[model samples]
Target: MAELSGRFRELQDVTSSPTSGVPLSLTQREPEPHANNPPLYDGDPNSCRAFLSQCLLVFALQPRRYATERLKVAYVITLLTGKGREWGSAVWDAGASFCTDFEEFRAEMTKLFDRSVKGDEAASKLARLRQGGRSVTEYAILFKTLAASCDWNEGALRAMFREGLNFDIQDESRLRLRLRRLAPHSSWRLEETLPSKSHPPPQSPLAEPEPMQLGRIRLSAQEKQQRLVQGLCLYCGGSGHFALSCPLKAKAH
Candidate 1:
């Protein structure tokens, strides 16, 4: 009887061991079917299609959640869709769109475009215009005119204009000429009357003799004393006698 018990215990251990008996691999089981009803999407073609369509709709309506480096793509997408108007309104209501850096602008742009265009042609055009020497206002005008000619919606053009105004081209000469035209009368005259040459003519140091020492003359006691003591004429600080006895003075006399 003891030998039989030992054999039975060995058989029990073998059945419990994973590698021994029928090995039970752990697997996630499918949820059991409800007894009373079925799932809303279970094996129904129409429901499955509807569910997928709704998911796509949500993605389409939602703003893209990733960062993008392409500014033109954002601009074009906003222009094509009505999202640009929404963005402009929000920014206007907030009272400003000029942020601290390009990153903030880009973030705002991405938020404005609900979806991203992988290789948008409109974006390429914007990039080219930016690189070309067109002012933002000029580009916006051209864009609006061209879009209108091509039968694009008017509302989109207006939104694009609002967004484009933030980018201005630097024209130094145009700015200077504009400022000159707008200046006050006095400022204008001052600018206009300024001498062409900054420096005056070079002067000759010894071209003519001074008036007080031009001719020989006798000096008074006071003048001679002043000249001897100070080495300068009493009338002029010249290296001679007083102005009263100067040759120029004698000529006048």
Candidate 2:
């Protein structure tokens, strides 16, 4: 420590001397942007919000840097002019005015994507939602996703989600009862509420009703003549006998 202090004082003494004509070396540098960073907002889909949100995950950034609007804009310019640049081309063809900053750009992109959800619109969409052919898991996913776009609280959201399901789904056993018992504003769980399409609900079609029995009727003379001509006995099943002289049927009298 003493040796280092002596050396520092000696260097200061040398620098303090007016005759020492060596100019002090400046060692400051401007931070350069990363050259290899991938372009954002390619616009295959409405991914601007996702991209921006992901920028906040600073764990992988060198020295954990924050993404500023100006920096984002610089990257945005690159994505506007390459192969698979439909989003950028659309922007240009429409002759939309350039954004003044990152927030304006994001807003315009969000509006373009129809991602800006109004309360009424979102509520109406959520209100009209139905389980349809999808399973409970799929329906839940869609419900939660649509609900995210709206400002409704969990309790009202759950009620609306339940109400929107198909009548069959609502009338389903234990599921309805359990969902009803949940506390307001709480999560509701399903234990196999919706059946898979592969295993549909048991279907028992209306069977043919029982037929009423009727008493046997006596044959008419025209029918008897027809039977006689046809060589069939009237009362008994023998072929040769007629009704009047039928011996097998005579035993009954």
- Candidate 2, after superposition: displacement of residue 251 in Å? 64
Query: How would you encode candidate 2's per-residue C-alpha lDDT over 121-211 as one tens digit per residue?
Result: 6556665677889765577667766677776654445445544555465445655454444323545443223343454433323342211
C-alpha lDDT score of every prediction, in listed order: 0.35, 0.48
The segments of candidate 1 whose C-alpha lies over 4 angstroms from its true place after superposition are: 1-133, 167-253
Number of the predicted model whose lDDT against the real structure is largest: 2
User: Which pairs of residues have clashing backbones in candidate 1?
Assistant: 215-247
Candidate No. with top TM-score: 2
TM-score of the candidate numbered 2? 0.41
User: For each candidate, what TM-score against the reference?
Assistant: 0.15, 0.41
